[model samples]
Target: MKASLLSAAILATAIVSVTACKKDKSTPNYAKADDFMASHAIKEQSFSGNAAAGFTITGKDGTKVTFSPNAFVDGNGNVVSGNVTVTLKEVLSKKDVLFSGVMTESNGQLLESGGEILVKAQKDGADLRINPALQNDGARVEIPKAMNKKDMGLFVQDKRQQGGATGGNQPQQSPYTWNPAPYYPFGNGPNSYSFSLPSFTWVNCDRFYSDPNPKTTITALPAFQDNNQVTDLQVMLVFKNITTVITLPYDFTVQKFQSYQNSLPIGLQADLIIIGKDSDGYIQFGTQPITISANMHIDAPIHKATQAEVDAFLATI
Candidate 1:
């Protein structure tokens, strides 16, 4: 058995080496990236200290895989530490799939969103099979019934667009745009505010892993608010028609996590309710729907009015 395993490793190394040496740019081979991940399957990784401070592992093909601290958050919002085995079903080039988002649950179970292909991973006794929800949306969808679980992770990108209005495979626009118009109104004036159709933001834990280095921070998008006053910010995401709500930290503020929102995949949407008591002690309510695809500025003003007016404005949202 030992000899056979050694021989298998040698043969696998040779196959990946050949796959990497291919010189054709027009039809570059991805079998090597796929193969390397298969041979080096990580059953469980152990981390100490801040597990939320994620780490990156570099594959033999130089692919850097990073995981956000939230990726390991349990259902109760606690960061997972200790020995956790995450299997890669398959590793393909960025050009292979349309949309792919991988998230691990509290028990370290893997969930794949978008993309027709399904990779199977096992946790405890249940079979983590391919989901049909991601297959319903786009044109020219191809759902592979099964995939190799140990190499399931595609190292190229987290989000991708195959064919769309822009024509061929192209990256989508920035998730958040910098605009200072929080007071901008929607339709008419003080009471009637216009709103985009509601979409939920995914913000249970704002931490993200864009790179392998723990010290590397996200600095692209700007801050939303300066002071941290409002807490209990929450966002939701829908997959396969199932709604999943994610909550942000109690001290979360617009300014602290606007940039984090900017890093989310384009096309994800969110909704927010603005309610409070006025100086006169009367309760006021306001709401706005936020889209994270191309625009980031919240121009709609929250109307502080009667319950009826608030309900009307919320109807538009």
Candidate 2:
């Protein structure tokens, strides 16, 4: 009887010890980690989050077609939630449209979900179409033709004429003679004018040319530094009378936001540059990166350019 009682006591203690150990063990929260991984993986695939989100579709001719989020449909005929932007080379007079958007499951299975679609002929041009099975084929809708050279040239000339005047009217004979001292961002005095220095230059070939073998060039400028970090830089370029190349000078490094979202082992990088001359003269302009965080939106350096100054600079090119 004593042996039996001792054995029971020993078994009860063992059960309690096992329960305590289990309580001490940390339960793995796979959900949170999975969520982070998923978000990061999709970051690179996300659109630039610009007002426009779509691909440009170019045809054999120079035409292109642009499609918005409203142009797709899922297998069940449900409209997709996300926006899709497409640019086509030229408008099609008549053609069949077949496209699809699908979501892949964790198990490597594809499921057709919500999407938008159109199927009709209007006086404007071709009809819009969507299909579930089409996703397997990897085909996209067609695009419209790009603007002709004459039209593009006219547009550029109009921009130059709108500016106050050209170098012909200026007293200075050199284009670089525009008082570089006053243009520096940290000039002293109440009436001092300052502007950010150009960061890069992009050159692109004119699309109007018959030859499609246009080459582009991009030149990168020194990065502006502040508090040990790159502060501001401007990229400028001209596009005119060239063939097919488009150049952009930019640090295409994977953005921090993208890195966090995509969970990429390493980020991506690219740059663009273009240069051209219009009927008025050479045209130069490029985009600059602007960071707006929760604490600050407009950095002091970016705000250095007054509206009048920007307009004047735009006019000169």
Q: Tens digit of lDDT per residue, candidate 2, span 91-173? A: 11111101011111111111111111221211113222333333322222221222222211100001122212221221111
Off by over 4 Å in 1: 1-242, 246-263, 311-317
Q: For candidate 1, lDDT tens digit of each residue in 154-200?
A: 11122223232223322222222111122321222132112211111
- Top lDDT model: 1
Model 2 Cα displacement at 239 (Å)?
A: 2.1
Q: Would you estimate the TM-scores of all the predictions?
A: 0.23, 0.22
How does each model score on lDDT? 0.28, 0.24
* Count of clashes, each model: 22, 68
Best TM-score among the predictions, by candidate number = 1
